[model samples]
Target: MANSIFIPLHAVPSGLNEIIDLIAFGFSDVGRSVPNVYSAKSSDADENWKDNFVFVEDVGSGERCWVSFFETTPDVTGNKEWTWLAGVTARWSWDFAGVVAYALCSYADSIVYNDSGVLTGQEEYSAKDLKGILSRD
Candidate 1:
């Protein structure tokens, strides 16, 4: 089973390219020092789904974690939004990958959406809660 969480960006800034760059920079700033942290972007048309997303993976020990982003439906006001997903493999702790996801969302001034699609305010996240969000078991 994997543990996962979804973060949604409320009002993305005007420039799309800038936001992508910001997310990449933010992830690097927080995750660069973590061992075996790697990042990639989807190249397949179907996989990308016309959204800007970066995927992060930890290629270290027995347990690994991953993070990525995807575009979601527009808000009521019709502003574009994105959902960032972070997850850890079974028995793995929320590590640098999770931190990078959080940092990317923070830099984008994003919000969180529960499984029910309700908006969650910008509140601090606990490891347990985040794991719960990512859990598939």
Candidate 2:
């Protein structure tokens, strides 16, 4: 029932490549399959959450999540389907909050400060802080 988590990034470690690599590494660290990440073409926008690291958990849940990045600001466009952090955005459409949260933290240097708990009334989460959060269903 929780929606999204926002990881505020100072700057992408290197570029889009690092974002893809760290997310893959982070997912592996969280026990999910390392996902294939690619770029979305501006010429042919699908209007779906594509062109980023995406994966579906096949262990029964089949929950889906996608990552979207922005420089100046994120175009929210009144999309309530996503939970937002601050720097980078990771959206879990159904559940798997801990997995997405863990991956974002991995990107922002193993620890991140977020104000994304508007729906959950939680705040200030870190990578080491996610052990309990990730333990839940």
Candidate 3:
């Protein structure tokens, strides 16, 4: 079985198409669905939309995770609020090279690794030594 984890991004940049494509390649099972990603909606009370969340899945192992982006905002009392706006649902297995490659190539800084394992697309990072740089941080 593949391990899963959540990767939270401060915000999803405009250049997300390429990353999505890469994630599709990395995971065998890729599906596009309308997800209730926004947290400000009234329907979020019971978490009914939780299942509606879209994600990528690893067909081989059924390991999956979701990516959510929320804009920071101030509430009525000036308190911080993580207003979820949009996100992607992804499911994957041990072979996450393609996912890693897509993520690194698209937005290396926004990446948040939840699990430690052999990542796909090691070749692309070889020259740039992304792994080395990432590890240092």
51 Cα displacement, candidate 1 (Å): 9.9
Q: Which stretches of candidate 1 lie over 4 Å from their true place?
A: 10-55, 59-63, 74-91, 112-137
What is candidate 2's lDDT per residue for 15-127, written digit by digit as tens? Answer: 44555577666666756665555445333223333334333243455555555544433344122322333343335432354555567676655444445653235666667
Error at 15, model 1, angstroms: 14
Name the runs in model 2 displaced over 4 angstroms: 41-61, 71-97, 110-121, 135-137
lDDT tens digits by residue: candidate 1, 6-61: 55554333343444465456445543433343334333323442344344444444
TM-score, structure 2 vs. true: 0.53
Q: Provide the TM-score for each candidate, comma-separated.
A: 0.43, 0.53, 0.33
Q: How much does candidate 1 score in TM-score? A: 0.43
RMSD of each: 8.4, 7.8, 10.5
**What C-alpha lDDT do the candidate models reach, one value each?**
0.43, 0.49, 0.36
Q: Predictions ranked by TM-score, top down? A: 2, 1, 3
Whichever of 1 and 3 has more lDDT, that candidate is 1
Worst ten in a row by lDDT for model 3: 28-37
